[model samples]
Target: MQIVNKAVVFESGHEEYAVPIQSVISIEKVNFINPIPHMPLYMRGVTKAREDLIPVIDFESVLYNRSLAGEEARLLVVQTESLQIGLLVKDAKEIIDIPQEALKQMGIAAYEKTKYFIGVAAFSDRLITIIDPDILVSSLEGIKDIQEYMKQNKLFPA
Candidate 1:
């Protein structure tokens, strides 16, 4: 028996991505998003869940340059060291324990947005890209502004 790193897998842009299960707070039904003006395209605004307000990241927009199907989306609430946010993913499937041997270092240089990607894990049927939520959130161009708006508007804790 062995202890493995487990992650929560979700679908975005017809591909699978993952974050550490330990970083996951909750998976919630998509709620109404109160949009803000002048925010980045990847930001879908703020939503209330788990008795708290959190900014919604449009995963499709952020990763795929596509619009999210809000009606069929799921809010994957995740927390980093200090900040909390929701990832609006196309679908959330399951949690899997990944063996240390299964993880591979990221080396792609063309994408230019691999800052958040920790590595890739290949299973029999699918390959999943694992990401660090902290890096992913911090890598966004207007994430600070988004966070500031949420804080100043009484939407999220400062």
Candidate 2:
């Protein structure tokens, strides 16, 4: 008898997508208790977790140029070098294990106009675009202002 196989599964944009579980960090409940004024549209708001106020970055809006349409969202905590940020996902799904061969490089046309989505991975009938949080944070004009405020407040890195 022959048997079929399943692959790495994850939640993206409220859909069931799959990727290597190795790329994923444990999902957490988004704390919507804090709010900031004049934040970019991609910034849903700020939340406090473990005594740190982390900015919740809206994933879909940043990547697809869309807005929050009332879809439930979650916070994906990701670490990039020395900086750690929370990714605001509309819906985070389960983790699945798939073959690395399924991954492919995204064409330049997809990012020639914008550097938002870095790459895409195909799983089943869905296409999942890998979001680079650093790019979003670095490109944000408010970052400098925030940094300045932090420096004035003595919160700047010493």
Candidate 3:
């Protein structure tokens, strides 16, 4: 018997990406995002989800260098070790179980360049890039600086 991993597939622009379903908390439609000053372009803003102010990132901008231009965008709330953030995706697809053998690990050089991507999974006719939530959350440019700012401003608990 082969072990299988489930992933929450999503579309960002024209590309498809997947994150381990275990890391995802919930999926919500794009709502009002209160912009934060001096943050990177990828950091869309923060949105109120329940009692928490979850920081949202424009996944398309981060991955493709393109802004997400549509009202149909959705947010995939993911949790890492130290933080919970929302990743903006153009669309949220279905959850699929992928065989462990389907994931092809990228080379170290490629991994270093694209820290957010763990590997690529070939499914049917499409290729889905597997995203590491931890890496994606931590690798954002100016993320630490902005997180410190958020902490200082009392936006997030220090």
Choose the strongest candidate by TM-score.
1
Poorest lDDT segment (10 consecutive residues) of candidate 2: 1-10
Q: Judge candidate 3 against the unseen true structure and give its global Cα lDDT, from 0 to 1.
A: 0.81
List, residue by residue over 46-110, the lDDT tens digit for candidate 3: 99776688888998888778878587788899998768888889888789888877887756425
lDDT of 1 at 65: 83
* Candidate 2 per-residue C-alpha lDDT over 6-95 given as tens digits, one digit per residue, 9 for 90 to 100: 323335456543323333354677656354567667766556555655556666676567764444666776544334456666666655
* TM-score between model 3 and native: 0.90
Model 3 residue 144 distance off true place after TM-score fit, in angstroms: 0.9
Error of 2 at 48 (Å): 1.2
Clashes of 1: 0
- Which candidate, 2 or 3, would have the higher TM-score against the true structure? 3
TM-score computed on alpha carbons, candidate 2:
0.67
Q: Can you give the TM-score per candidate against the true fold?
A: 0.92, 0.67, 0.90
Model 1, global lDDT: 0.84
**Over 4 Å off in model 3, which ranges?**
1-4, 108-111
- lDDT, residue 6, model 3: 90
TM-score of 1: 0.92
Which ten-residue region of model 3 has the weakest summed lDDT?
A: 104-113
